[model samples]
Target chain A: MKSERANRRMMTRLSIFAVAMFGFGFALVPFYEKICEVTGINNLIKPAAAVVNTQVDKSRWVTLEFDANAHGLEWEFRPVQRSVRVHPGEMIQIEYDVRNNGAKAVVGQAIPSYGPKHAAPFVKKLECFCFKQQPLQAGESKRMPVQFVLDGALPADVNTITLSYTFFEVKGASTAPAKGGVQG
Target chain B: MEAVHGHTNDHSHDDHAHKPSGIMRWVQSTNHKDIGTMYLWFSFTMFLVGGVMALIIRSELFQPGLQIVKPEFFNSMTTYHGLIMVFGAIMPAFVGFANWLIPMQIGAPDMAFPRMNNLSFWLLPPAALLLIAAQFMPGGGAGVGWTLYAPLSTQAGPAMDLTIFAVHILGMSSIMGSINIITTILNMRAPGMTMMKMPMFCWTWLITAYLLVAVMPVLAGAVTMTLTDRHFGTHFFNAAGGGDPVLYQHIFWFFGHPEVYIIAIPAFGVISQVIPAFSRKPLFGYASMVYATASIAILSFMVWAHHMYTAGMPVEAQLYFMYATVLIAVPTGVKVFNWVATMWKGSLTFETPMLFALGFLFLFTLGGFTGLVLSIVPVDVQLHDTYYVVAHFHYVMVAGALFSAFAGIYFWLPKWTGRMYNETLGKWHFWLSLVFFNVTFFVQHFLGLAGMPRRIPDYALQFAEFNAISSIGAFGFGLSQLLFLYIVIKTITSGEKAADRQWEGADSLEWTHLPSPAPWHSFETPPVVK
Candidate 1:
């Protein structure tokens, strides 16, 4: 009888411990997420901002044509390209168009980079679709242009700067950088 | 009146029961002594296995060129050595000592849960086996360092999975062991022994157990997230997948930071017990020692982020961690001063345990000071991930924990074996280890400050000489450990019989009531404390 009583008491304590541990562990889950969100570190998926890209550089911006299946995107991007070299204090311009080939409207963010060391160029803009999430209506197309001068501060010995963009799907639309160009 | 009026207490002890002996006795043992013996031997085997891995690493690092192991293999050795030493050797060794001593000292018949104690110990062997087998897996054992940082670890091979599994099992074992310790202390003390009257070793275990309880599960959670991220495509840490990698670090150090103290605190306990007994004095300022230990455990949680200063935590966050890390020195300072104060004005004798205890006090304090310096964020930015950090921890752990363990063994081996060890060879073991250990790690601080990073198989031309010297010192230190093996074997096989009271000042209940080798079964009925 005494052993039975002891066993029963032990079971009670064990159950209590189990409950307490669960409560303690569960209490932490919500607290951790709230803290992460408030810190701008919420890596969890959220809606992206919207903006549209417009072609700004008119003349030197050579139009681009590429096979859509090759790059694995649902849109066609036409780019203005080809510059041999630029002397110091020269400007170059480029233009591009994104034609939506998908059945549904899409949202995305465009990451743009430039030069042999791509992604080092700091972009300044009068207007950009990238300022917020981008959204497009179904069966729609848009043109984006990036224009800028090669700063005179660039070393005279250096030559060639190529720009590239990899777009991530966002909630709405992407703003484009201004496009333009001159001799190298 | 040389105790002539005593009612033949000696013969009364003899009259109780002769101890059960040998292999069968150990297999089905519940006695703390038998279990402790098993733990000690097992831990030493692990130390050698881990040491062999260390030697492989050092040999590869003997010169700037890697002649022995490949880079992948070098990474494996570093990972395996750390895992084995931290889990397999030091922590188990301390638990073993606690198992053997806490009940004995507290005057309880056995641990609060004897059957569970056996189960907890038995789990370690299989866990170690699985970890070792991981080396033969598809890409070889965890190329990730002991930290096992995420995304990289997730991207690694099958070996990483196996290592994670091993960590999960080990964490469970630690939790069970720690819970057992906390329960035993809370429920099983003798009637007369208040918390204050409890031995310093028990006091230390109580605190260590608390640290283990609070942190080991966090480690479990961290590893759980790692497992999920690797297998289930959960973005707990992948930035591309909507998870932040730094979050993984925050959770890991929450566990990792206290984990070091978990290893160190019990070593502190061992020294606290050994120092006073050999010094022929009661421990000085026992209350303060208790407070200091408690304070250290509390502070361990606060200082986890100090490790993340380089992880790009906010500057304000860095400042907070830095200050908290340095403040740890105050309580730790109290501990060092208390140890020194205990030795002052006392009739101190340099017994084997005393020799090791004193070694811990000196070397551990130096290590702690370095730890303080590491906490200084500006200093740490340069020292982080360098050999200085390596040297600092080794001085604290190898010199501090391992030395104290050796001392504890020698001090108690007489009472456990009913025989005294050969004093001369024991002294040789002490001197050789102490001299060579310092030689090996002291130079590492210089190598670290000179901008050498750890965990690489090769070095620049300038680092070649120090690498050679450090390797040589390592070999010497490794060989001296064999001297210890000789002493223990020889003493156990044949030596002079010891009296029940092995040391004159030893007053724990183990010396009073239990005979040498304790018994095959004790506290089948609990002994009353008074």
Candidate 2:
């Protein structure tokens, strides 16, 4: 009888631990974002709302470089303008042209990352084409625009911030050859 | 006195029982031993299945120009091979050992939850089926590698969902099994067998069970998120949906890093028992060994990001992970030193089990050292996703965990089967496996250092020679396992009789008290452990 009670208690404790760990797994998403925010690692930068600072720092000029890569997607993706000189707190727009070179219509999603990762916090994206999936018909081409403002609070030491986007083919969005041929 | 009276009452209740026989016995068995046997057989079958997949991989890599299988199929083979071996073969093999031995060692009638034990074992078959059947699916098995990093996994075919479901089922089985182990170890020890006084195997397993419960659910959550992202329009791993691909890696390795120890600590237990027995000495620094195991478990959680050094983590995060990863060597060094000290100045015998344990000690340390080297951010940046990483894990996983498992099987087969195996054949099996295993994995380190990337079906001409040599070695290792099968079958069918005390130095209750082949229901009347 005593052993039975002990067994029940242990089981209960173990079950609770299991459940807690499961919750903890979900907790890691927000925890991961928090850590990224603190450490400025892995391009997991949380976008901040645009700051309306009346005073602008015109003395400092930072170069914002645009880069694009398409992984396993036969889409020709490139930034229209390679690099731009912008003052702190200045809003700028850039265009990227993408064409589906494949035989059928395709859906693509662009994922953005900022290099000189410390600068990720200051480069706020007010409106970006990366926010949604872009579907293109066969032999179709489209120009996508990203509008962003560099916050005035940007760090002094960082001069160059390279924003790169890699477009991946989204599953279930492409109706043609949906099953087998997609390579990672 | 009350315990003694309870034992008498238990004996009287069992006196008139008639045991079931034949197929029905196994199918309906709530007996721990029966369940254990089933687990062992199932794992061995999966071992062969996974082994065949490995051979296919080696065969294709022999010439490095898509010789046998296509690149996609090759990817599938590697993915399923890793999944099947880790989940289906190695984990279940240790669980089989735990089920068969834990109750007897603790002087208990059976696991605390017998029916749940049966359910856990049975859950494995369907999971294995789902995993295997995935290969025959519309596209193929999951080819995003065993880590199943997203974006790639998101683009995979229908088979990916099957793989995810299989993983969920496997995790469920592991959680239940862990709970059973924890309950039995904590609550069901015989009277007078205090926790500190228990055998090292039980202590190691108790720690392992805790690690399992803590991490398996996390793995379940990771895969479930993958399931939703793949099918339910969830953006957990979709970047366009504001999710990061690296987050999948972080979550996966959170479960994955502890998982390395999950496969390892039990093997440590097996070696701790085998080393002392063969040396005719008590285990050295018993209390310290337990503490070291705990320390390794605790440190395991902190070092997970070491696997992600190349994933562009912050330099500070990399430095922290690197230091914590290197700190693991301290406790691990204690374990190695204690094993050596146990064998120091004692009458020692070179039985098959001891030979494998020594091999495990040597090769596993080499693996550990390479792990240390890989933990450095700069070195890992160069070596990540190379054959060197491949060689390093096979050293730890195959040599560290698998070789120790062989040692355990050889050491305990007589007790389980009531007959001695052919020692000559066992020695031959051990030597061949060691030689061929080295031949296979050693050269791959050079290939990796030479900058040959992993997961490629075709490699540059410079890598051809080593790839060919490694392929031949893999074939030799695979063939040598046939000898192990024959020896086990021969022992079970007919062999020299085994005594209750199979080895002179074995001091555990299971060895000292049980008959040659332990009875169907062990310790129905529990022994007082004094």
Question: lDDT: which candidate is best?
Answer: 2
Worst 10 residues of 1 chain B by lDDT: B1-10
Query: On residues A14-131, what C-alpha lDDT tens digit does candidate 1 reach at each position?
Result: 4355345434433444466677667633422332222133334332322212111113347665554533343332333455566667777765445443453421322222233333
RMSD of each: 8.7, 5.7
TM-score against native, each model: 0.80, 0.89
Report the number of the highest-TM-score candidate: 2
Give model 1's TM-score for chain A to 2 decimal places. 0.46
DockQ per candidate: 0.08, 0.39
Tens digits of per-residue lDDT for model 1, B1-530: 01111222222233224444567656655556566767778799999999999989888888888698889989989998999999899999999999888877876656666666776777788888977998999878887888888757767888888888888788777776776777677667766778998888999999998777777777777777788878775666654334457777777787788899999999998888888888788889899999999999999989888876776655777899989998899999998999899899988889888999999888999999898899989999999999999999899889988998998999888877778899999989999998889888899999999989998888889988888889998999999999899898898888787776788777777776766645434343444555
Report lDDT (Cα) of residue A46, candidate 2: 34
C-alpha lDDT of all candidate models, in order: 0.73, 0.87
Alpha-carbon RMSD, candidate 2: 5.7
The Cα error of candidate 2 at residue A21, in Å, is 1.5
Worst 10 residues of 2 chain B by lDDT: B1-10
